[model samples]
Target: MIHFTPKFYLIGRVTHTGTQRDGTPFSQVWKTIDSLGSGTYGDVVLQELQGSPGGGCLHAVKSITKKAHKNNKKILTNELKALIAVKKHPTKVVTFHGWYQDSQQTMFIAMEYVSGGSLERYMRKLKRVENILISSTSPLLVKICDFGIAKSADIDASGLKT
Candidate 1:
Protein backbone atom coordinates (compact mmCIF):
# COMPACT_ATOMS: atom_id res chain seq x y z
CA MET A 1 0.00 0.00 0.00
CA ILE A 2 1.19 3.49 -0.87
CA HIS A 3 0.91 6.10 1.83
CA PHE A 4 1.08 9.85 1.20
CA THR A 5 1.88 12.59 3.63
CA PRO A 6 -0.50 15.50 3.26
CA LYS A 7 0.95 18.84 2.22
CA PHE A 8 -0.82 21.99 3.26
CA TYR A 9 0.36 25.05 1.42
CA LEU A 10 -2.25 27.46 2.79
CA ILE A 11 -5.20 27.51 5.13
CA GLY A 12 -7.77 24.91 4.04
CA ARG A 13 -5.77 24.35 0.89
CA VAL A 14 -4.22 20.94 0.35
CA THR A 15 -2.22 20.17 -2.77
CA HIS A 16 -0.75 16.84 -3.73
CA THR A 17 1.74 16.43 -6.56
CA GLY A 18 3.73 13.27 -7.03
CA THR A 19 4.27 10.20 -9.15
CA GLN A 20 1.92 7.27 -8.96
CA ARG A 21 3.01 3.63 -8.82
CA ASP A 22 2.90 3.52 -12.62
CA GLY A 23 5.23 6.54 -12.92
CA THR A 24 2.36 8.87 -13.80
CA PRO A 25 2.32 12.43 -12.45
CA PHE A 26 -0.54 12.76 -9.97
CA SER A 27 -1.50 16.35 -9.35
CA GLN A 28 -4.52 17.83 -7.58
CA VAL A 29 -4.43 21.56 -8.29
CA TRP A 30 -8.20 21.83 -8.57
CA LYS A 31 -10.49 22.35 -5.64
CA THR A 32 -13.72 20.44 -5.11
CA ILE A 33 -16.32 23.16 -4.84
CA ASP A 34 -19.66 21.35 -4.95
CA SER A 35 -20.88 17.83 -4.62
CA LEU A 36 -22.26 16.15 -7.73
CA GLY A 37 -23.90 13.26 -5.95
CA SER A 38 -23.60 10.86 -3.07
CA GLY A 39 -24.17 7.18 -2.41
CA THR A 40 -23.72 4.67 0.38
CA TYR A 41 -20.02 4.38 -0.37
CA GLY A 42 -19.11 8.04 -0.71
CA ASP A 43 -19.77 11.38 -2.36
CA VAL A 44 -18.75 12.61 -5.81
CA VAL A 45 -17.66 16.21 -6.18
CA LEU A 46 -17.13 18.51 -9.12
CA GLN A 47 -13.57 19.80 -9.40
CA GLU A 48 -12.14 22.49 -11.68
CA LEU A 49 -8.73 21.20 -12.63
CA GLN A 50 -7.68 23.01 -15.76
CA GLY A 51 -8.58 26.47 -17.02
CA SER A 52 -10.03 26.95 -20.48
CA PRO A 53 -12.17 29.41 -22.40
CA GLY A 54 -15.33 27.39 -21.75
CA GLY A 55 -15.14 27.00 -17.97
CA GLY A 56 -12.02 24.83 -18.05
CA CYS A 57 -11.89 21.06 -17.60
CA LEU A 58 -14.16 19.78 -14.87
CA HIS A 59 -13.67 16.36 -13.27
CA ALA A 60 -15.73 14.22 -10.94
CA VAL A 61 -13.83 13.13 -7.86
CA LYS A 62 -15.07 10.39 -5.58
CA SER A 63 -13.99 10.47 -1.95
CA ILE A 64 -13.91 7.04 -0.30
CA THR A 65 -13.34 7.27 3.42
CA LYS A 66 -11.04 5.03 5.40
CA LYS A 67 -13.86 3.66 7.53
CA ALA A 68 -15.32 2.01 4.45
CA HIS A 69 -11.93 0.56 3.64
CA LYS A 70 -11.98 -2.06 6.37
CA ASN A 71 -15.30 -3.58 5.37
CA ASN A 72 -15.25 -2.75 1.68
CA LYS A 73 -11.70 -3.48 0.62
CA LYS A 74 -12.92 -5.98 -1.90
CA ILE A 75 -15.42 -3.50 -3.29
CA LEU A 76 -12.77 -0.79 -3.63
CA THR A 77 -10.36 -3.20 -5.25
CA ASN A 78 -12.99 -4.29 -7.71
CA GLU A 79 -13.71 -0.68 -8.65
CA LEU A 80 -10.06 0.05 -9.46
CA LYS A 81 -9.69 -3.25 -11.29
CA ALA A 82 -12.78 -2.66 -13.37
CA LEU A 83 -11.68 0.87 -14.27
CA ILE A 84 -8.27 -0.32 -15.35
CA ALA A 85 -9.78 -3.22 -17.29
CA VAL A 86 -11.95 -0.88 -19.36
CA LYS A 87 -9.55 2.06 -19.64
CA LYS A 88 -9.12 1.59 -23.36
CA HIS A 89 -12.80 1.91 -24.29
CA PRO A 90 -13.37 5.62 -23.70
CA THR A 91 -16.54 5.81 -25.79
CA LYS A 92 -18.18 2.93 -23.94
CA VAL A 93 -17.21 3.92 -20.40
CA VAL A 94 -15.94 6.72 -18.18
CA THR A 95 -12.29 7.53 -18.58
CA PHE A 96 -10.29 6.45 -15.53
CA HIS A 97 -7.61 9.11 -15.04
CA GLY A 98 -6.03 7.65 -11.89
CA TRP A 99 -6.53 6.91 -8.19
CA TYR A 100 -4.66 8.05 -5.12
CA GLN A 101 -4.85 8.25 -1.35
CA ASP A 102 -4.32 11.16 0.97
CA SER A 103 -2.47 11.38 4.26
CA GLN A 104 -5.67 10.41 6.06
CA GLN A 105 -5.97 7.22 4.04
CA THR A 106 -8.98 8.57 2.18
CA MET A 107 -8.96 7.29 -1.40
CA PHE A 108 -9.93 9.49 -4.32
CA ILE A 109 -10.78 8.49 -7.88
CA ALA A 110 -10.53 11.10 -10.66
CA MET A 111 -12.48 10.55 -13.85
CA GLU A 112 -13.71 12.45 -16.90
CA TYR A 113 -16.20 15.10 -15.88
CA VAL A 114 -19.52 14.46 -17.63
CA SER A 115 -21.28 17.78 -17.94
CA GLY A 116 -24.79 16.55 -18.76
CA GLY A 117 -26.86 15.27 -15.87
CA SER A 118 -27.58 11.62 -15.23
CA LEU A 119 -29.63 9.55 -17.70
CA GLU A 120 -32.71 9.51 -15.48
CA ARG A 121 -32.68 13.28 -15.11
CA TYR A 122 -32.01 13.78 -18.80
CA MET A 123 -34.94 11.56 -19.77
CA ARG A 124 -37.23 13.39 -17.40
CA LYS A 125 -36.30 16.74 -18.90
CA LEU A 126 -36.70 15.45 -22.45
CA LYS A 127 -40.17 14.08 -21.70
CA ARG A 128 -41.27 17.37 -20.21
CA VAL A 129 -39.93 19.44 -23.10
CA GLU A 130 -40.80 17.21 -26.09
CA ASN A 131 -44.02 15.79 -24.62
CA ILE A 132 -42.84 12.37 -25.74
CA LEU A 133 -42.05 9.33 -23.69
CA ILE A 134 -38.59 7.88 -23.97
CA SER A 135 -38.06 4.14 -23.88
CA SER A 136 -35.02 1.85 -23.54
CA THR A 137 -34.87 1.52 -27.34
CA SER A 138 -34.28 5.25 -27.68
CA PRO A 139 -30.89 5.98 -29.17
CA LEU A 140 -28.82 7.51 -26.42
CA LEU A 141 -25.20 7.31 -25.43
CA VAL A 142 -24.76 6.26 -21.83
CA LYS A 143 -21.73 5.20 -19.84
CA ILE A 144 -21.83 2.75 -16.96
CA CYS A 145 -19.97 3.95 -13.87
CA ASP A 146 -19.80 3.04 -10.17
CA PHE A 147 -17.92 -0.23 -10.46
CA GLY A 148 -17.68 -0.67 -6.71
CA ILE A 149 -20.15 -3.57 -6.88
CA ALA A 150 -18.68 -5.04 -10.05
CA LYS A 151 -17.44 -8.63 -10.03
CA SER A 152 -15.01 -10.44 -12.30
CA ALA A 153 -15.68 -13.86 -13.75
CA ASP A 154 -13.83 -16.84 -12.36
CA ILE A 155 -11.85 -19.19 -14.56
CA ASP A 156 -10.74 -22.75 -13.91
CA ALA A 157 -7.33 -24.22 -14.50
CA SER A 158 -8.43 -25.71 -17.82
CA GLY A 159 -9.22 -22.21 -19.09
CA LEU A 160 -12.72 -23.30 -20.07
CA LYS A 161 -16.20 -22.99 -18.65
CA THR A 162 -16.38 -24.39 -15.15
Candidate 2:
Protein backbone atom coordinates (compact mmCIF):
# COMPACT_ATOMS: atom_id res chain seq x y z
CA MET A 1 0.00 0.00 0.00
CA ILE A 2 2.07 2.90 -1.26
CA HIS A 3 0.33 6.02 -0.18
CA PHE A 4 1.63 9.19 -1.87
CA THR A 5 1.10 11.93 0.61
CA PRO A 6 -0.59 14.99 -0.86
CA LYS A 7 2.52 16.89 -0.10
CA PHE A 8 4.38 14.82 -2.64
CA TYR A 9 5.31 16.86 -5.67
CA LEU A 10 2.49 16.75 -8.21
CA ILE A 11 3.32 17.14 -11.87
CA GLY A 12 1.40 17.03 -15.15
CA ARG A 13 2.18 14.36 -17.74
CA VAL A 14 1.17 13.43 -21.27
CA THR A 15 1.28 10.01 -22.95
CA HIS A 16 2.46 8.89 -26.36
CA THR A 17 3.76 12.35 -26.84
CA GLY A 18 6.82 12.05 -29.03
CA THR A 19 8.91 9.57 -30.99
CA GLN A 20 8.80 5.98 -29.68
CA ARG A 21 5.71 6.95 -27.76
CA ASP A 22 7.89 8.50 -25.14
CA GLY A 23 5.39 9.77 -22.60
CA THR A 24 4.84 13.50 -22.32
CA PRO A 25 5.97 15.28 -19.23
CA PHE A 26 4.66 18.72 -18.56
CA SER A 27 5.36 18.06 -14.92
CA GLN A 28 6.82 15.24 -12.89
CA VAL A 29 3.89 12.80 -12.94
CA TRP A 30 2.16 12.33 -16.26
CA LYS A 31 -0.88 10.78 -14.74
CA THR A 32 -2.20 9.13 -11.58
CA ILE A 33 -4.14 5.92 -11.14
CA ASP A 34 -4.51 2.99 -8.79
CA SER A 35 -1.36 0.92 -8.31
CA LEU A 36 -1.35 -2.67 -9.59
CA GLY A 37 1.70 -4.51 -8.21
CA SER A 38 3.63 -4.53 -4.99
CA GLY A 39 7.22 -4.98 -3.82
CA THR A 40 9.10 -4.20 -0.64
CA TYR A 41 10.31 -0.81 -1.80
CA GLY A 42 7.26 0.43 -3.67
CA ASP A 43 4.47 -0.58 -6.03
CA VAL A 44 3.66 -0.31 -9.76
CA VAL A 45 0.61 1.64 -10.72
CA LEU A 46 -1.29 3.14 -13.63
CA GLN A 47 -1.50 6.91 -13.35
CA GLU A 48 -3.10 9.72 -15.34
CA LEU A 49 -1.89 13.25 -15.74
CA GLN A 50 -3.57 15.93 -13.75
CA GLY A 51 -6.25 17.85 -15.71
CA SER A 52 -5.40 16.04 -18.93
CA PRO A 53 -8.65 14.06 -19.09
CA GLY A 54 -6.53 11.54 -20.98
CA GLY A 55 -6.68 8.87 -18.24
CA GLY A 56 -3.62 6.89 -17.10
CA CYS A 57 -0.94 4.56 -18.34
CA LEU A 58 1.13 1.71 -16.89
CA HIS A 59 4.17 2.70 -14.85
CA ALA A 60 6.35 0.98 -12.28
CA VAL A 61 6.85 3.24 -9.33
CA LYS A 62 9.75 1.94 -7.29
CA SER A 63 9.58 3.34 -3.80
CA ILE A 64 12.74 3.02 -1.75
CA THR A 65 13.84 4.40 1.54
CA LYS A 66 16.84 6.72 1.44
CA LYS A 67 18.70 4.20 3.56
CA ALA A 68 18.06 1.39 1.12
CA HIS A 69 19.19 3.52 -1.81
CA LYS A 70 22.26 4.81 0.02
CA ASN A 71 23.14 1.25 0.97
CA ASN A 72 22.99 0.25 -2.68
CA LYS A 73 24.04 3.55 -4.21
CA LYS A 74 26.96 2.10 -6.08
CA ILE A 75 24.87 -0.47 -7.90
CA LEU A 76 21.87 1.79 -8.23
CA THR A 77 23.92 4.62 -9.65
CA ASN A 78 25.41 2.34 -12.24
CA GLU A 79 22.05 0.94 -13.20
CA LEU A 80 20.47 4.35 -13.42
CA LYS A 81 23.28 5.87 -15.42
CA ALA A 82 23.35 2.88 -17.73
CA LEU A 83 19.63 3.00 -18.19
CA ILE A 84 19.75 6.68 -18.99
CA ALA A 85 22.48 6.22 -21.56
CA VAL A 86 20.68 3.47 -23.45
CA LYS A 87 18.18 4.01 -26.21
CA LYS A 88 14.62 2.74 -25.97
CA HIS A 89 14.28 -0.86 -27.10
CA PRO A 90 11.30 -3.02 -26.38
CA THR A 91 13.31 -6.22 -26.80
CA LYS A 92 15.81 -5.28 -24.12
CA VAL A 93 15.10 -3.86 -20.70
CA VAL A 94 12.24 -1.72 -19.52
CA THR A 95 12.32 2.01 -20.21
CA PHE A 96 13.05 4.62 -17.58
CA HIS A 97 10.18 7.07 -17.60
CA GLY A 98 10.98 9.55 -14.85
CA TRP A 99 11.77 9.87 -11.18
CA TYR A 100 10.72 11.87 -8.15
CA GLN A 101 12.06 12.45 -4.69
CA ASP A 102 10.97 14.10 -1.49
CA SER A 103 12.52 15.42 1.69
CA GLN A 104 11.29 12.23 3.31
CA GLN A 105 13.34 9.06 3.07
CA THR A 106 11.55 8.06 -0.14
CA MET A 107 12.49 8.13 -3.81
CA PHE A 108 10.41 7.00 -6.76
CA ILE A 109 11.54 5.87 -10.17
CA ALA A 110 8.81 5.62 -12.78
CA MET A 111 9.52 3.11 -15.50
CA GLU A 112 7.68 1.36 -18.31
CA TYR A 113 5.45 -1.32 -16.78
CA VAL A 114 5.52 -4.44 -18.90
CA SER A 115 1.98 -5.70 -18.61
CA GLY A 116 2.95 -9.38 -19.01
CA GLY A 117 4.84 -9.48 -15.73
CA SER A 118 8.30 -11.06 -15.40
CA LEU A 119 9.74 -13.73 -17.66
CA GLU A 120 10.34 -16.12 -14.76
CA ARG A 121 6.73 -15.91 -13.69
CA TYR A 122 5.53 -16.30 -17.23
CA MET A 123 7.65 -19.43 -17.59
CA ARG A 124 6.15 -20.92 -14.45
CA LYS A 125 2.66 -20.31 -15.73
CA LEU A 126 3.51 -22.02 -19.00
CA LYS A 127 4.76 -25.10 -17.16
CA ARG A 128 1.63 -25.27 -15.07
CA VAL A 129 -0.51 -25.10 -18.16
CA GLU A 130 1.81 -27.42 -20.11
CA ASN A 131 1.78 -25.12 -23.11
CA ILE A 132 4.85 -25.48 -25.24
CA LEU A 133 4.06 -22.65 -27.63
CA ILE A 134 3.39 -20.15 -24.90
CA SER A 135 6.57 -21.24 -23.18
CA SER A 136 8.66 -20.15 -26.15
CA THR A 137 7.52 -16.56 -25.95
CA SER A 138 9.13 -16.14 -22.55
CA PRO A 139 12.61 -17.09 -23.72
CA LEU A 140 12.28 -15.09 -26.89
CA LEU A 141 11.22 -12.00 -25.05
CA VAL A 142 13.85 -12.49 -22.40
CA LYS A 143 16.53 -12.74 -25.03
CA ILE A 144 15.40 -9.55 -26.66
CA CYS A 145 15.39 -7.95 -23.23
CA ASP A 146 18.89 -9.24 -22.66
CA PHE A 147 20.06 -7.63 -25.86
CA GLY A 148 18.57 -4.45 -24.61
CA ILE A 149 20.58 -4.68 -21.41
CA ALA A 150 23.74 -5.58 -23.25
CA LYS A 151 23.30 -2.61 -25.51
CA SER A 152 23.39 -0.40 -22.45
CA ALA A 153 26.67 -1.70 -21.13
CA ASP A 154 30.29 -1.24 -22.10
CA ILE A 155 31.30 -3.86 -24.68
CA ASP A 156 33.78 -5.68 -22.46
CA ALA A 157 32.00 -5.63 -19.12
CA SER A 158 28.88 -7.42 -17.81
CA GLY A 159 27.58 -3.87 -17.67
CA LEU A 160 26.81 -1.99 -14.46
CA LYS A 161 24.43 -3.17 -11.75
CA THR A 162 24.15 -6.86 -11.19
Q: Which pairs, if any, clash in model 1?
A: none
Residue 53 C-alpha lDDT in model 2: 51
lDDT of 1 at 14: 43
Which tens-of-lDDT digit does each residue in 124-144 have in candidate 1? 544222211122334655665
| Model 2: lDDT to the true structure | 0.45
lDDT tens digits by residue: candidate 2, 1-162: 111322434443323222223443332235555565554444456655544454345565555565754555544444455656553443565566655555675656666655554544545644322111121354554321112212234422443442
**What TM-score, computed on C-alpha atoms, does each candidate reach?**
0.67, 0.52
TM-score of 2: 0.52
What's the CA RMSD of model 2 in angstroms? Answer: 8.3
Best by TM-score: 1
Model 2: how far is 7 from its true place, Å?
6.9
Cα displacement (Å) at residue 60, model 2: 1.8
Give the poorly placed runs of model 2, Cα more than 4 Å off: 1-25, 28-42, 70-72, 125-162
Whole-model lDDT, candidate 1? Answer: 0.61
What are the RMSD figures for all models against the true structure? 7.1, 8.3
Best by lDDT: 1
